[model samples]
Target: MSYDNILALNPRIQAHATLRSTVAKKLDKKHWKRNSDKNCFMLSQPNIYCFEFVEKLSHNIFETIH
Candidate 1:
C-alpha cells in the first residue's frame, strides 16, 4: 500500500508502542491493568498533570439530580 492510500498512522503506532515498552522501566515497574485512554491524555506526564487536574476538577463539580 502506498502512503496516499494509507492513513499514515504508523508513526503514531510506533510512538505508542515505544512508550508502552518503556512504561515499566519509566513508571516504577508496575503492570497497570485497569486503564482506558480516549485520546484525552498524551503519553507524556499524564498522571502527573492531566488526570490529576481532571480528578480535582471533578471533585469540585456540584452533584445534582436529573
Candidate 2:
C-alpha cells in the first residue's frame, strides 16, 4: 500500500479518538526521526497527515479499534 493509503487507513485504525496525541505518544522522537528519514517524511506535507490529521485520525482509529 502507498503511504497515502496507510495514512488514509489511519482513520480506520483510529476510529475517531485523536490520532495526533495517540500517534505522537506511541512514536517517540527517535521513532519519528527514523520513520521520517526512511519514508522521506515531512510532517508539513500538504496531503499527508500532519499534526492535525494525526489528531483526527487517531480519534477515528481509536474508536474503530475498540
Candidate 3:
C-alpha cells in the first residue's frame, strides 16, 4: 500500500546483503558530493547499490521510465 511497505515486501531486498558500515568511508569526506541541483550526497562509486543512496536514485530512475 505504501512505498516503505512495498520496499519491505520486495523479494530482491532479501537476495542481497547490507553493508556493515554507514558510508563507504568513515573518515574521508571526498566520497561525498554537493549537487547544487539535487542537494543530496552522491556516492562516489561505480555502482548505486549502496543503500543510503537508493531512495532518490530510485525516484530518478522511475521518473525516466514514466
Candidate 4:
C-alpha cells in the first residue's frame, strides 16, 4: 500500500493543524528570520508554552504509546 494509505490506517497519525493567516500576520516582525530558501520567515525566540501545556503533551504521548 502507499504511504498515505498506511498513515490513514495508523491510529497515531492525525490531521495537522495550521495557523490562520490573520493570526500569523499578528506576530512581531522583529522575531522573524528569513530562511536560507528565502521562501518563508521562521520565528526566532518564539513564545513557548507553559509547563502545564508540556505536562499535558507528555501525558497524551504516554497514553498513546500504551
Residue 10 in candidate 1, Cα distance off native in Å = 44
User: Alpha carbon lDDT of residue 5, candidate 2?
Assistant: 80
Off by over 4 Å in 2: 1-40, 43-49
lDDT of 1 by residue, 1-66 (tens): 887557665544444444445656746434453565455645654467777887777777744321
- What tens-digit string does per-residue lDDT give for candidate 2 at 1-66? 789888986655545765457667766765656444555355346654476777899999999999
- Pick the lDDT winner: 2
TM-score of each: 0.27, 0.28, 0.23, 0.30
Which residues of candidate 4, in runs, are more than 4 Å off? 1-49
Pick the winner on TM-score between candidates 2 and 4.
Answer: 4
In angstroms, give how far residue 28 of model 2 lies from its true place. 31
Model 1 / residue 62 / CA error / Å: 4.2
lDDT of 3 by residue, 3-39 (tens): 9998988676377776666465543444454534353
Candidate 3 shows a clash count of 0
* Candidate 4 residue lDDT tens string, 1-66: 899998898687558975678656646443484534342232453335555576799999999999
Model 1, C-alpha of 3: deviation from truth (Å): 45
Where is model 1 more than 4 Å wrong at Cα?
1-39, 43-47, 62-66
Model 3 lDDT, residue 5, Cα: 95
